[model samples]
Target chain A: MEIMELTALELGREIKKKEVSVREAAQAFLTRIAQTDKVLNSFVTVEEEQVLQRADEVQSALDGGASLGPLAGVPAAVKDNICTEGIKTTCSSRILYNFIPPYSAQAVLQMQKQGAVILGKTNMDEFAMGSTTETSAFGPTKNPWNTEHVPGGSSGGSCVAVAACEAPYALGSDTGGSIRQPSSFCGVTGLKPTYGTVSRYGLIAYGSSLDQIGPIAKDISDCAAILEMIASYDPKDSTSVKRADCDFTAALTDDVKGMRIGIPTDYFGEGLEEEVKQAVLQVAEVLRQKGAVVEEFPLSLVDYAIPAYYVIASAEASSNLARFDGVKYGYRASAYDGLHGMYKKSRSEGFGEEVKRRIMLGSFVLSSGYYDAYYLKALRTKALIRRAFDAAFEKYDVILAPASPGTAPKLGQSLGDPLKMYLGDIYTISANLAGLPGVSVPCRVDQNGLPIGVQMLGNCFMEKKIIRAAYAFEQARGRWQAPPQAQRKFEKETVSASADDMQRKEKEMRSASAKDVWKTEVKTVSASAGKAVD
Target chain B: MANKISDETIEYVGILAKLELSDTEKEQAKSDIERMLDYIDKLNELDTSDVEPLSHVFPVNNVFREDVVTNGDERARLLENAPAAKDGAFQVPKTVE
Candidate 1:
């Protein structure tokens, strides 16, 4: 009866079995988004017309006896931070609020090619700063389970969209646990693939090295299907890996038979909520029963990740975000004739508070005197953190930890305290620092009925192993209960085929002079080491 | 100097970030930054002399692909986002003159 609550795999089966029409399934998501998005505030822009047209095309293909893809006809959403052509792909920042990218992000384009019916673009923290989605220029995406409670962000909307079943799957970019923290809080599944596994062509840079595009879905299987569609050797992205001979979905197996799963004592220690710890241990027990050799390993210095991540992420962010300076793209403030006026008015009017804070902090760290003391130190510590993970992984196939310390906290509580919200990334940051594959799978619901997640971290390019292990846990954890509020999301979905609104967005953005930033028209700045690989 | 970070430094950083800050922010950032710097200074005490500084965690090895000029999609939308443009190129205020 509730087709919206079904996983991508389940929906695919239903469509193939002729039990549900692809068009009907697309409509169910549209309807769900329309009804529930008001409360959840997950999606910033939904292309309803595009969803129906894409569904029709898929249906036509199915009728003509064409083989459907893994996630055929499944409705999915994109994070606003990711580039989507002709759409208002804001990084939830005012600078890019009215900006429509010339190209779609590599991940979005790939997912579309796989016949995944894109539902819409979801909200995020402005420029992917701040842990709570509250920093979004479009406003915070409320948790589907509780409107008053904060959805952990900057990918909070993506996580909430999946958790609330506005779409069965969504794409999110994680820099310092943007994807995983929200995934944990929203009680859904998300994976921050190995650093170079997914291309970053279209996703705007938050913290360049720290940023990775990942999948947020209801289950590990859904996450896997989306990953298969998105992951590949993208020549456009220099960091992309040549696709090794691997099938992530096919690698899903219940046998960890003799596989070593490590529970780092530091991960389970102080500040970890009892409910989340219990949930992680329960999942570990399931793995143990499946013949996994589980052990308590020592990574005692894990407490240092927050400060290191902040410094590194902010330091990089300072330079990366300097691109939207009212000259090239997006909104520029009026009443400014001079260059300095343009910079001041544009940035001050464009950026939200958290983004401003991060940019300022970043600029400070990277400034002349502070670079060695702050930025360089953070980079050095990042190496140490990577070594800790590498040492642990030499003994263990995968590392297990509670994704966030607890369920989604009450909204407005985490907003005031930036450092406290940052602590949620304590368990997730090291993986990004190490360039390892990490997956967050929901294990159980706490007494409060909010979901608790156990994250599995694997060695580089070992997404297959992590996906397999996460799938095994999903099977053990039993079926997830889609939130009730996300179910009524039976509303219309709207896609931009370049009508009046696109013209208006263009008109609003028409001011000052611009330049093509892609072709190296701007000034070439030096990297820290001076002319190494930029 | 006790290897100490100061209020003036935070204020200077805030200026670089283009943040118009108040008195409270200046003090708060000074304290917060000092706390972080102090924590990171613990690494200075570590004997990492023999260990080579690892810049990238993954073995990237300059993994570059052949550069091919792929046609960028959406001819009209490319200009849609420009604050100002003409003849398919973005127009900007004169500089480097």
Candidate 2:
């Protein structure tokens, strides 16, 4: 069997049976990564030697008659945004490009304790500002499915790694749609656990209020299994939630018989392309067919999500990112003689355009005169959105939506108008604003055969139900296809279709939408290169 | 959009942020701030009277644990990467200097 194709559960069983040494398992993945990483570029750094060493240590433990842990020998990748002790966690920004942290995140520590081998840090957008990995300062991560296309971001590298079968699973941070969008694009299961479900001690804050570190995996079970390990309260993270007293893994039984699924009319009404809407509704139909009662729900306040999220997240980010000045930590400007010069040089040289743009916007929103009007008012509107969700979830077990309006757009296509790019996250951002647990499960492929993900949203701390729904959907829909490049030349040719055709076809898909007024297509001509014109 | 932000307001913000902007940057900041402010102006259309303001999306409050220390004696590692330190504290140039 191809070692790369083994799920975490399979790998665990193999190691437990002693059919394969942990070192050998880690080595197999490292070798596979070395062979194909040139094409995938899924990893920003591959901690090869240390991984083998840790695997050997696990093997030594097992050989010495110690009880093997549940996730023994499972190798996983982490988004660089999540800090790992003594690793260069750049978040794909020049500011922290060489930052070696002294401590690992609590989630990473939990995974390590489960006997999961740490592979390496994966790439992301600088400060996780962009939906496409094209904003990465290091370079864009190519979709393993098609190298020319983008793997969704800011967790693009993590999703791409899982999609390409580089690792059994990867940890990704979602602020807005980072994890789910990338998962949707790459054809994997990704979850953004309820805001406080997982500890956020060492996650580099992109949007402090919204950022959540969760699992991106080949299937929902693996995603839930990983979350089960990582989700717990920690004294270190003020946002951590106490234990929910329910076993997430056990909660995933095929029991949607009495489940009330809410299909938000606003989610499918406008902006969603025909194929994505059809794919989402098809899943809704399947749920209905399976005896689950599905209803069309309403959230009048949900349309204000992007604007509310931008105001709140950007304001928080401005405050959080202020710590990156030259004096404290991160990249320092040694060329400057004075303190002011040092700070300016460091920031000007370090931040990307998007990062700078957010800071400026954030500063403006939180600034005097604007604070009460913009930031405070947006917060109030955010409550309205949350209240609506709170009311709907009272009648529904799960809310449904398309994770992204459509599959991954060509890189340069969405970048021309920033507002248009912001709308790509419209369907997913509200979940973050509501601090709800959400999962994006690949429902079906589009007309162009690129993947589309349908979102399953749940009330706060009900991650188990979200995962259960996603898992059941996966059991029905099937395991995601390994990115075509994972195979040989013939498969590569099949995946490597023309970008022009993909974009034009995506536009045509939008044109065919049942609702004519949404104007989903923004014919961005600049996506001619690797990704965003940015 | 007005496409105008007072130069005085820009200077005030720069001061608050401890930034010294170039004259050209001041012009750019003015326009960007105006556009962003204009965009944000749309929030007034929202009727939030019935809404209870949420400080956190998750219904978590006072997540504070016991104020007891749990083996947090890592001053050495904390100082290990400091750009400058002296006598178990971060060093800075004299404020009066």
Candidate 3:
């Protein structure tokens, strides 16, 4: 069997039947990461020793005739922002470059408890603040579909890891569109659970109210299985909800009969790329053909979502990030005269440009004079958006829209302009603001051979409805074909070797001056309101 | 549309955020902050007088657990992440005169 081509569930079954040992699966994935990650830059840290140790433990348990968990022996990756014990969780910023957590995130513990072997910590936007992965203090994670383009972020690395088949599945957080946007860009299935469904105990807070950790996998069923492992209430997180026992995998029926699917007309308005709109509309047709009730509806309060999201997310980020001063933990300034000076210099030097910009925007909005004008206004707008969603949910079982306005852009296309970058998130941000369960599944590929995703939004705790619908669509559409870039044979590259050589030389030069220039560039870019809240 | 934010405001905001900024960054921050503010000012078009502000999405509030420790002490492990540690606690620069 092609190890990289197997889904998590399929690999688990094979491991149980003794067709593949845990160690064999883990070793294959680790080797793949070593070979492909250099080009994709998906992982920030890969712990080979720890990974092998876990695999050994699983193999021993199996030898003792133990019934394995749903994800038994499946190799997985995690977003860097989710704390993993004994491993560095950098959030792709210099501040936490050496900050290793003493404990794993609650979601990660649950995954490990289910016999999942963590392959490594994947890279992400700095502090999960940017749209594309370009703002990472480490180099950007390239799109696996097209190496020249970006994988959408701030969960870009997680999406890339799974899409590149470096791991069977990976965990990602969606404060806004971090999981779904990248899943769409890289042509995979990702689900952003309802706001309070997944525990946030160890997820480094980007927007506390908006953040939820979810899964990215090759198919929706694999995502459902992973979600089952992690979705539980924890007393550690006050916002987490007590859920009834749910079998998300069972919800993967190929039936959408009698389902009421709402298509948001406002999502198809100006700025939505023509191809993405047609693809999503085509999804509506597919669902209708499956005996579901699909209709166009005006989702009110559409224009205010992006603005409200930025303001509220930035404000929360500013407050949450105040804990990062050099006095306690994380990076401390090497040269400083006093406590206050150290705080200033450390933050100035520690953070990347995008992170600082968000901190600035957050502080400005929550500052004394501007609090009511910006922050309070945003809160009210958030309330309105939530109310609008609630009203819509009363009518429709699920809402459908484009995951992103278009396919992934070139790496630096949105980096130079902040507003343009923010606009790419317009379709995905409202679900976060409303605290609704949202998912993205790859439906079609655009002319540029990039993936396009159709998003589904369901009411709180109604993930079953959306998952059932997406599964039906997936069944009808068939699984996405691996992009050409993903299937590229590593050894027989004849054309791009000189280009690769030039890139290697450039990388050497960049790494030489990266540290000094990183701090200065961070300061320079901190003034711009970079992408906010995941 | 051109440079709506003033430099003095950026300085005050930077101080509040505990970030040191150079003159060039201050200028960049001014333009960026102004552009963002201008974009966010779109909310001013609607009347939100009757709307209640929502700080959280869920209705649950005052979630209280038994006031007891649920986790073991891991002071050494926690301190391992500290940039500067001494005497089993995080050490910082002098605060007193």
Candidate 4:
């Protein structure tokens, strides 16, 4: 098998046995990224020299007889929202286009300490505000399975990187299905840990109360391993939790005997695509046959999740994003009359339409006349949603639902209708509302050939239950195959030109100080230039 | 529940958010906010009168730490990414002329 085909753990084992050098593994994935990422748009920044340098460092550490854990030599992608020291972490927005962090996120530090080779940041929705990655200041990431469709977001680039085999695993932050929905759309596995399980420090807060960083990978095992490496308690983030039961890999057993899996009947109702519903139900069947006790149950307050989620998340986002004025680190208006003018013009010019809408919505909900009606009511609804999940968990160990209403939608279908996009998050947002751990495992491919995911949500801090269930489901499902486009090898001559062009564009971007030049350059460099294979 | 968000409200909220919106964007924002508020009104259907507000899902209290210096000053490094910095501090436009 090719090095790109190996799971992260598999590659780590080969490196440990001296069969594969860390440099070789990193190079193989980097080469794959060079060839495939043009079409996928899976990456925002890919520093080839830095990646190789990290690989060499890991190789030296391995040669010196130091064990750095399972992810030692793995090349992992991080969503651009996460801070990386000396790297431009833009969160796929123009406001932070020129901003470089002085300190790395706690998760990035954890990965670095484990000797993992950082493969640069992946694109995401601008400040992680939208369901489709199309809202990014950078271009949207196309689904690997089909280029016309979106790889769901705000973790689209991370999911696309893994799905297209550009990277073996990636770190994706979830705030209301950002990780799980994209994982489903891209035919990958993603896990959003319970609130505070992973430190939120330097994650570029969108909705602080709901956002939790997690892992997206080729399968549940890789997700578990990646989660194990990055999950930690940091004093920097006040919400970071210290957990004694964080050994996620230990729950990889195939046994789900007598495990109670509750399928929410509400999730299978109207608006759910028939094929998607069947695919999720098939997961229930597979688990049932494997000795899991599967039954349908009513998960109350299902319809209220989206509105409450939007209200609360937007309120938090308004407060969190208030930091990005022209003064501190980020973009500044070239000309402004005064302090207030600078703030207004910089934010107005920097933020995209979707971001502006959310900010306005948040401002409205929290404004004087509307706070008690909209903001406080949403909080009360949030409490009731949590109580509903608490009650459901009393009877069932894990609740199973469809990750999205259906498979991946076409690239432009979601953005025009913001409410339609918001409703797409119905199935997955409740987990964030209740602070539950949720995992999305690809169940089956729809008639349109896009993959559908079965989401397993567990009560707070019960990551093991969902992971075990997902792992068991994966075992039953057998090995997943990458999309034909990703697996197809192009002739070297056809690939080199586009790859070189991309490399040159990246170089020019690094040298250029003007943000407008960078934006125009990105827009002009279309991936369609390398479409000779189809 | 206000089904219709007035143009005045949008303008006021724009000022609160520190966003300068053109007339086109203001109209767009007005309709969008109206639609979203209409949808958010769904939450009103479920009587949450007895339920307490849940700001954070987890029962985490305010974290406390001793007042001890963790690291030496890195003022230069901190100022590296500033759009306008001088004398080892962020420089903003004059608030009072």
User: Order of all candidates by lDDT, from best down to worst?
Assistant: 4, 3, 2, 1
lDDT of 2 by residue, A18-96 (tens): 8888887888778777766655667777778888888888788777877655677788899998999977787887777
- Full candidate order by DockQ, most accurate first: 4, 3, 1, 2
**Candidates in order, interface RMSD in Å:** 7.7, 13.0, 7.3, 9.7
Strongest candidate by lDDT: 4
Global CA lDDT of candidate 4, please? 0.87
After aligning candidate 1 to the native by TM-score, how far in Å is the CA of A183 from where it should be?
Answer: 1.2
My TM-score estimates for the predictions, one after another, are: 0.88, 0.88, 0.93, 0.94
Candidate 4 structure, TM-score to reference:
0.94
On a 0 to 1 DockQ scale, where is model 4?
0.57
Fnat of candidate 2: 0.35
Give the distance in Å from residue A381's predicted Cα in candidate 1 to where it truly belongs: 1.6
Error in Å for residue B41 of model 3: 0.5
Error of 4 at A331 (Å): 1.2
lDDT of 3 by residue, A1-534 (tens): 597898899999998888999999999999988778767888889999999999999889888977668788899999999999898898887787777899899999998887889999998999998878888777788888887789999999999999999999999999989999999999999999988888998999999989999999999999899999999899889998999955788898999999999998888889899999999999999999999999999998898999999999988998898888865566776666567887899899888777888889999999988999999999999999998898899889999999998899997888888877998899899999989999999999999999999999999899999999999999999867777766774433333633463475356334433334424443443445351111
Q: Give the per-residue lDDT digits (tens) of candidate 1, residues A183-262.
A: 88888888998888899999899887878999988888778877888997786777777877446788777768888999
Write down the C-alpha DockQ for each prediction. 0.36, 0.25, 0.54, 0.57
- Model 4 spans > 4 angstroms off: A489-534
